[model samples]
Target: WLRGTRKDPPTLDETIAHENKRQQLEKKPINMLPTSYGRDAAQGGTGKCSA
Candidate 1:
């Protein structure tokens, strides 16, 4: 098996900071709106037609 180049492991402080950031992101509310696709003029998307 071919092994890729490995990087140094994160320090204690770095690991703690990463975990804290992950937790903060996990608690954040995901506010996303549905989008429209295709050439349908009625549906909202790129208003103008493509060449």
Candidate 2:
């Protein structure tokens, strides 16, 4: 039968470590608007306008 032949998967600790590494790899820095944009409306290009 396949039951005995199949090996056990990763342990809890191993699984957690893998997930943590994956999250770190997927993380990225957030982009914020420059303060200068607040002073000049023309400098800040109009983003997607809805009707």
Candidate 3:
């Protein structure tokens, strides 16, 4: 159960779900931030925002 040996991080769906839940719990608009930058993005693995 070590950090390196553990499973990969949550999928995009899970991340989005968690973000949505957090937003709802706080009762405020969640100012979205980029999940990654440059060529190392994780936003669906596209690494670029598309509107």
Please report, in order, the local distance difference test score of every candidate based on alpha carbons.
0.41, 0.41, 0.43
Runs off by more than 4 Å, candidate 1: 1-6, 32-51
Residue pairs with backbone atoms closer than 3 Å in model 1 (clashes): none
Q: List ranges where model 3 is wrong by over 4 Å.
A: 1-6, 28-51
| TM-score for each model | 0.44, 0.40, 0.40
Task: List residue ranges in candidate 2 displaced over 4 A.
Answer: 1-6, 28-51
Cα distance off (Å), candidate 2, residue 11: 0.2
* lDDT of each residue in 1-51, candidate 1, tens digit only: 011253656668766765675456446565522232223334322232211
Pairing residues by index, what is the TM-score of model 3? Answer: 0.40
Candidate 3 on 13-48: residue-level lDDT in tens?
A: 866866675455346335633332312332333322
After the best TM-score superposition of candidate 3, give how far the Cα of residue 34 lies from its true spot, in angstroms: 28
* Number of colliding residue pairs in model 3: 0
For TM-score, the strongest prediction is 1
Judge candidate 1 at residue 23 and give its lDDT.
59
Best by lDDT: 3
